[model samples]
Target chain A: MFTGLSAFPLTPFVDDAVDAAAYAGLIERLAASGVDSITALGSTGSYAYLSLEERSRVARLAVAHAGATPVHVGVGALRTSHVLENVRSAEAAGASGVLLAPMTYQPLTPDDVFQLFATVADATELPVIVYDNPGTTHFTFTTELYGRIAQLPGIASVKVPALPEGDAAASDRMAQIRAALPDHVTVGISGDASAAAGLTAGCDAWYSVIAGTLPEVALRIARAAQSGDRDAALQASAELQPLWNLFSTMGGSLRVTAAIAELLGLVAPRSLPLPILGLTAAQRAEVARVSDELGLGG
Target chain B: MFTGLSAFPLTPFVDDAVDAAAYAGLIERLAASGVDSITALGSTGSYAYLSLEERSRVARLAVAHAGATPVHVGVGALRTSHVLENVRSAEAAGASGVLLAPMTYQPLTPDDVFQLFATVADATELPVIVYDNPGTTHFTFTTELYGRIAQLPGIASVKVPALPEGDAAASDRMAQIRAALPDHVTVGISGDASAAAGLTAGCDAWYSVIAGTLPEVALRIARAAQSGDRDAALQASAELQPLWNLFSTMGGSLRVTAAIAELLGLVAPRSLPLPILGLTAAQRAEVARVSDELGLGG
Candidate 1:
C-alpha cells in the first residue's frame, strides 16, 4: 500500500506538549506539495519518545490535515500487545496503514519476530508495512525472516533500510529481496540519502525523512527516478548531498531536520532524548549555507 | 543508598499481564532470604517491555512485599518527562530510591547525558542510582560523565556493569571510579559473575540478577567479599561458574533466570522479545545439573 515518496514529519513539541498548530501546519504543507503519502510517528517523528496519547493525537492531526493523501502511522513497540494497541489507535485515527517494526528490548529469535508481526497483523485489518530499521530497532531482519513475514495475513509491503555507503552488494541484495517476495508485496526503501540509488535499483517507494520538511525537493528527485530520468534524479540527490552529509555526520536526520524545521519557522525549538541535541551554531550555519545555495528559504 | 547484595527479580507475565501474585511471591522470597535490598523494574524485571501502569503495579507489589528491605525502582525512559513521571509514581508507591539509565533511541552526547541525570535528580528527593548498563541501554557513561552526574543532588550511587571476561583493565578502572567519587556515593556492580571480583575490588554493592532466584548463593559470595575473605569469595564465585557461563553464552540472564525460576517453581513460563528464546532441553538439563550440584532448589 506504500508507494512513491511518503513524508515522515517531525513531531513538534511545545512546553512538553504536542504543538498541534505547528504539526497541523506541517501536514498541510506536505499535502499541498502533492506528496504521495504522509507517515506519522516515524523515526523522524520521534514515535518511540511520544506517549500513547500523544501518538494518537499526532495520528489524528496528520490524517485530519493531509487532505486526500493517505496517512501511515508507525505502530512499533517493545511488546506485541502494545503494537496491537497502537494499531487500533491508528486505525481509529483514520490512518491508511500501520508501519510495524520488530522493536524489542530483548533479542528476538526468528520465531519470536514472526509471532510479533503475525499477532499484530491478525489483530488489524489495515494493511501492515513491515519496517526493517536495524539502526533504531537494533534488530536486523534477514532475507529469510523477511520472506516469512511477507507471507503473513494483511502484510502489504516491506520497508528496507538503505545499505551502508559503497556496498555494491546492496543493489544485488535489493533485487534479490524483490525477486524473493510475492508479486503482491511492494518493496520500499528508507534512508533519504539512499532513495535515488534504491529507486534506480527497482525499489518501489521511498519512505522518506527529508521529504517531511522538504517535500518539493524530495518529490523532484523521486519523480525523476520514477520517470526513468537517471541524470535528473542523481542531480537532485547531489544538490541535497550537503544536508544528507549532515545527516550522516550527525548520526541521523531527526535533529538536523528539527533544526531545519525551526529555521524555516515550521516548528518551535525542541529537545529530543538526550545525546541527540539540536544542531550547534556551526552546523546551523552550514545548513543555512547549503539551504541558501539550493534556493531553499523559510 | 543501595548496599550489599541487591536482588533484581524477574517480572513474570501470565497471558501478557503482570502476574502480581507471582511477582509479590518472588519479592517476599527475596526479602525473607535476607537480601540487603530489592530492585524492582530492573533489566531482569523487563522494565522496558512493560507499560506505565504495569510498571507502577510492579513497583507497588515489590514495595508491598519487600517488608523491611528497601526497594529501588528503575525509572528510566526514552524521554526526560517520562522519567520524571515515573519518579513521581515510584515515590507515590513508596520506593526507597529510583534507578536511572540514560536510555534513548538515539545516541546521546555527554552534555545530553549529564542533563538527563541532572534533571531527574532535581525533580525528586529520592536517591537516584545511575545505571551504566551499556549492554542494553546502548549508552556508556565515561568517568568524566560519571564525575559530572555524581555531583547531582539526590544522586546516591552508580551501578557499574561487569566488564567482559579477562579485561584486566576493568579492575584498575573500577578502583579509579570508586576513588574519584565522593565518599558518600556508593559504587555498585551488576552482572552476577563479576560480583565477587567487583566487591573484592572495593565496590560497596552487588546489584545481582542471580540473587533474585538464588539469593542464598549470591549472598554467600557477597558476604565473603564484604568480610575481605578473598579466598572464600573466589570459592563461592567458582561454585556458580556453571550458571555464570550460561549467562555469558546466552547474552543475558533474563531468559536463563526465567527458565531457572520455572524449574524451581518460582514463576510461570514466560517469553521475552524475539531472538532470545528460553533455554532448550539440553540447556535446561545443564541448569538443573548445576543447580543440583550447588544444592539450589525450592
Candidate 2:
C-alpha cells in the first residue's frame, strides 16, 4: 500500500477558514487519478498551520472523498500527547497510515527523536511512516536513527528527502537507506524535482507534491519509472522542468503549487493561509505561462 | 520593561494539564526576586507543545501572578493568523509586551519573516520583541533582517542568541546588532551561560533561563553587570558553571530546569509535557548535587 505515488493535496483556505468543498474536490480528483495513495495534511497541505479540529475535519474529508484510495494522514505535532491525539483522530477517520515527523522547537537530540517514534508506534495500531522532510520540519533523520526506528514495531515506511540527481548517487543513497531498514519497510522519495531520479534509481514510492494538484503528470513519470522505463521517466520529468524551475525561484513548492492550483481553479483565488502571500501577480503569470507552455492546463 | 534580567519560567504541567497553582507560584517567586521581567511561554515554557487554550491560560496566569513585575508573553505560532490570535490574548491578559519568534514548519524566507513581523506589529499596539533564538526556532536571523524588522513600529527589543565567548568578539557582535537596530529597540541576550559576557559587553538585558528557577543567583550576576562591575558579574556567572555544564550535557536547558523545579518542589515530579521525559533518576541526582553544591537551594 505504501509503494507508489502518494498525492498530497492542498487544504485550501478562504477568509481564514478551511475551504471544505474545495478540499473534497481535490481529494476526489486524486482518488480517480489512479495514484497509489492520497496523503492529506502533508507539508504541502499546510498541516502545521491548522488547528486540531481543522486537522480532524480534513482527515475525515480525505477519507470520505478518496474512494478506494488508501489515505495516509500527517500526525506530526510538537508535543507527544498532541501527536498521539492526531494519530487517534487519523485512526478514527479510517486512515490507512499515519505519517510522523519529529516537529521540533527546542533542537532535539537523536534519543529525543527515537523516543518520539517509539512512543507513537507503541500507542497506535496504524502503520507509521517516518517523515524525513528536513526542508519543512527542520529535523534531519540519520540512517543509523532510521535503522533504530525501523526496527521498532509498526514502523512501515520512510518518506525521505529526494535522492541525489546523478543515477549512481541516487542508487547509492537508496541502497544505504534500504540496507538500514527491514524488508517490510519501504522507502519513498519527496522533493518533486527529484522524483524521477529517485524512482528510476530504485525507490519503492514517489511521495509527490505535484501529484496533489496535477496527479496525471506525476503519475506519467511514476508509471514509467516503475515499469523499468528509466529513459521514459526522465523524459517525462524533464518536460516539467519549467514547473520545477518555478518551484526553485519561487522559494519552494507550496507557493508555486498554490499558484498552479489557483490558475486551474482547483481552489480559491488567494487560498494560502495568511502571512504566506501565495505569489505576486507577475509571479502567478509566469507560473501560468510555464503551465500553459508545458500543456499542464486541464 | 525590556531591560535587566528577564526570567523565562517553565510552564509546569501536572497529569497532562497545566498546573496553574504551581505556575502562579513560580511567577510570584520571580516577582519577589527582583528580576527585571517575567517572560511566559518562551521556549523553556514549552509554548510550541501547548494548545491555544493552554497558551492563553498560561498568559493570563503570568500576568495575574506577576504582581508589579512586567510580564512578556511569547506569542509565536506556525501560522501568522494564530500568531495574531496569540497577540490578542497577550494584550487581553495585560502583558507588557509580546515576544515574537518565527516558529516554522516550512523553512521560511527572509521576506516571509519580515511580512510576519510587519503584520503582527501593525495589528497590535503592544511592543513586539523580535525573538532570534535559532537553536529553538531553527530560523537564523541575519543582521540585515534584524535591521529591516527593527524599522517596524512596535518592535521594542531583540532577544538574540549568545554572543561570542571572547570579550572582544562579544563586544563586536553586540556592536553590530546595536548598529543594525534603532536606539529605541533594546538588545537583550539569551543563553544563560553567556549572560555576564553579554551584559558586560553592552547588552541591555539578559533573557535568561536560569533566572526563572534561581533568581537570586541570576540577580547577583545581573546586578553586578548593571552596576558596571564586570569582574563581579563574571565571577558570579562562573560560580554557576556547574549548572551551565549540566545544561549543555542534558540535551538543553528545559530538562535540567524541569529537574531543578521538581527538586525544589516548585512543581510535581514528571511535570514536563510527554515524550519529553524530563530526566533520568541519575541525571536528576546530578542536578540535585550541583544545585546543593552551588547553594542554589532556597
Candidate 3:
C-alpha cells in the first residue's frame, strides 16, 4: 500500500562482506525519512550476488529496521524451486511482500511464466509483485501474460522496468495492463529515470533506485510527484539520469551494485565472489562524479 | 583425457518423478557401451528442469554406474551461489567432473567468468568442463578467457556446441586455446553433427547428445571419427541433424526435451516448465519421424 514513495535500497558491501550495520543504518534513515516502502535484496540490493542465506538476512534487516513501512524482498531465482524457497524465507523473515523479476531463467513460455509466479504465490502468505526487467533476463513477457498472472491470488502488483518503447506505446501497454487488472493491483515503475513519466502515464508507484542510495533526493521527487509537481520530479530525474546511466549502462547485478556502493561511499573491499567484476578505476570515478552531482554521497 | 566419445545421458522420469531405477539402468547400459565418458544431466537429461534432490540422485546414479568412464554433471544456475552448490553436490556424488554453462545469468566479464569456473574448480577435487552452448547459455567464453580458465586447476576440458560459427575461425579459436593450455586439457565437441570437423580440426574429444538416447547411432559416429572416416562421420551427422534441429528449433528447452523423450520412448511426459512451451503437433511428428528414420528404436 505504498503511495508517496518506495525506495529500492542499494546493498552495502565491504571487502567481500555484506555491510549489515551500514545497510541497517541506511534503511533506518530511509524509514525515518517517511519513505512509504522499502525494497531490499533487489537488483540495486545485489540480490543475485547474495547467497540465499545472505538474501534472507538482508530481507530480515529491512523488515526489522524499516518499521511500519512495507519491506519488499527480491525473490526471483534461476530455478522455480529456489524462487519458491526464497519467497518462503522472505515471508518467514517478516517481509511485507516479495518483488521479483522474471529473469534468471530463459526462453520460458507465458504458461511457464504463470507457473513461476504462481509457485511463489501459492508458497507464501505474503502478496507477490512480478518484476519484468527484460534486458537482464534476456526476454520479455507480453502485456497479455501479465494480465493473466495478475489474476493469480495475492498478486498485489507488478514491477516492470520501463520499456523504452516511446510514450504512446508504453502508455498504451500500461493502460492495457491496468484495464485488465482489478483496481487494487498497482503498477510500480523501476528505472528511476522514467518515474515521472510512468506516474504521468498510468503507473501507481515509483520503485526508486536513485532514492535507494539517496533517500532525501528520492523523497523530494516522490513528494513532488504526490503534489503533482512535474518540474521538480523532472529536475530530480535530470540530476539522477547520469548516475543511473553510469550503472545502468553495464548489464549485470554486480556492476549496478558496485556503482551503488560507490555512491554511498563504499568501495572495492566490497568484492563479489567471482564471474562478477568490480568497476574499473575510470568507471568508479565516473560513478563518483555523477553521484556527487546528484548529491548521492555522504 | 578422452579422445573418442562422451555421452550426456537422459535422466528418466516416471509419473513426473525422477525414476531412480530407470536412470541407474540407463547408466549401466551407457557405461558398458564403450563410450570414452558419460555426461549426466545435460539437456538430453532435461537437467534444467530438475530439483536439487533429483539432480543429486541422478549424479549419484551416474557415478555409481560409470565404472572407469568419467561423469560430467551439469551445473548451470542463475545465481553463482547455486552453481557453486551444485558443483559441490556433483563432487560429493563422486562425479569425475561438472559441465557448467553460463545460463540463467548474463553479462559476466572475463574475470567473473574465470572466477565462476575457478570457484567451482577450487571448491571440489573433480575436474570441471566449461560448457559453451551459446544457443542456450547465451554467453560465449573468448579463447583468451578459455585459456585462462584452463590454467585454473581442475578445469579438465572445454565443451563447445557446434553452430554455423564452428568454422575456420572457430578452429583457429580452438587452436589458440589449445596452444595456451597443457595437452591434458581437452576441447570437447558437443554438437555430434560437427564432431568430425571439430575432431579433425584438433579438438581432443566429442560429447554426443544423440549418442545418449541412441547408443547405436552415437557409437557409429564416434567409431567413424576414431578411425578418421570423414565419410562415415558425415553419414552419421546426416541422420543426427534432424534430431538436433528438432530440439534446437522452437519451444527452446521444453520442446527439445519433449523431442528427446519422444524418440527414446522415455517418459518426457509434457512440455518443459514455465517460460518454455511444447512443440506443435507437426513438430512432434517430425521428432518421431526423425527418430524412426534414424532407427533409434533398436
Candidate number with greatest TM-score: 2
Q: What TM-score would candidate 1 get against the native?
A: 0.95
| Best by the DockQ measure | 2
lDDT by residue (tens digit), candidate 3, B141-258? 7877778888888888888766345467767867677787777888888766677677666677887776665666678877786787867876776666766666557544345545
Model 3 lDDT, full chain set: 0.72
What is the per-residue lDDT of model 3 for residues A30-93, given as tens digits with 9 covering 90 to 100?
8887888888877767686666678778888888998888888998765565677788789888
Predictions ranked by DockQ, top down? Answer: 2, 1, 3
| Tens-place lDDT digits, model 2, residues A167-256 | 788888888999999999999999999899888888899899999999999999999999999999999999889899999999899999
TM-score of each: 0.95, 0.96, 0.86
Which one wins by TM-score: 1 or 2? 2
Q: How does residue B143 of candidate 3 score in lDDT?
A: 72
Residue-wise C-alpha lDDT for candidate 1, range A123-184, written one tens digit per residue: 88999999998877778788988899999988889999885454476678876897778888
True contacts kept of 2: 0.73
lDDT of 2 at B19: 96
Ten contiguous residues minimizing lDDT sum, candidate 3 chain B: B268-277
The predicted structure with the larger DockQ, 2 or 3, is 2
CA lDDT, every model vs. true structure:
0.84, 0.92, 0.72
